[model samples]
Target: MAPLMNRSFTTANTPGIVHIADSAAKRINSINAKAASNPPQAFRITVDSGGCHGYQYVMGLTKEINPAEDVVFEKDGAKVVVDKVSLDLCTGSTLEFVEELIGSSFQVVGNPKAETSCGCKISFNVN
Candidate 1:
């Protein structure tokens, strides 16, 4: 009998991973500077189902690391971790931190999995 070949299915032409932007790096550095006194274990980037468009980007600090999660990018001691499932949807995506008159937040841009995004830029339509 012949051995079977492994087959894999992936979304768009997105890469496995990517890093944050230069501006995001600066902001992360600043955050690390302040977190120096009370540093977190890692920074987590996640996509949850719920938003104006259909999906929303969620980010926060994490002290406990999940064995199943994958570390995609890290800079200036700031690390970003995404679960296998989320990684599949965020491949070739860039994580950026934007500060505006309204507020400052972490965002996932250039997502190959995204089919469309809301006007607020807080949500997306994933394929």
Candidate 2:
């Protein structure tokens, strides 16, 4: 069978998988292209406390990957690596590039396990 390549698919077909938006994949690919580093950096997602909603989501670019501690998901040549700990809270969500009036940024939306979230989008309380 041919492999899935340079494509995006819906979550309905893959339970427990965090979907990546095309905008996000493009953004990551653009960033990595500029960096031009080996082992190519991947977008990293982490969850931590200290925010209006008690917990918060953090995203950044990283070249280091601890296989034992992280899970990497890729789409359209872009990669997203999440710590196992955070994945439990954000599974079934979508990683997206959001452009708004205030500013544009990457965010996680439609988190099935999140009970509540702040207007800023980064702050949240997991269910």
Candidate 3:
């Protein structure tokens, strides 16, 4: 009998640490391009507790630097920085944008730390 071998997958050449939809990326890029005068110092993504599911996603453009923040991924002029506390909860996650009839929003997909998420898709529960 032959022994089974495990196969591992890696993301080495992936374009961005946070994946943006084509439409979303185009919009963000357009906005970023116009910021040449005073471009964003950095983009920050954080996880907080408050949502019905016990966790919420927060994102913003930051000018102040936090020495303790952990940089998870950056690509295509888009950078994603997560705090040490959130890093453990966001490892191996991909950021995505979704446009629907109701609205458009940025969401985290394939989060290994998430055990379940709300129907609205705005929050998650960590395992």
lDDT per residue as tens, model 2, 40-61: 7899989888799887898999
Misplaced by over 4 Å in model 1 are 1-15, 37-40
Model 3 TM-score is 0.71
lDDT of 1 at 123: 87
Provide the lDDT at 78 for model 3.
50
Better lDDT candidate (2, 3): 2
Write the residue-wise lDDT of candidate 1 on 1-127 in tens digits.
1122222222234346756676666676677678784654566778888898888877776766665455436655555677767777677787788888998877888998899999777689887
lDDT value for model 3: 0.61
Give lDDT per model, in order: 0.68, 0.81, 0.61
Clashes of each: 0, 0, 0
Q: Estimate each model's TM-score.
A: 0.75, 0.86, 0.71
Candidate topping lDDT:
2
Instruction: Please tell me which model should have the higher lDDT, number 1 or number 3.
Output: 1
Error of 2 at 38 (Å): 2.7
lDDT of 2: 0.81
**Which stretches of model 2 miss by more than 4 angstroms?**
1-15
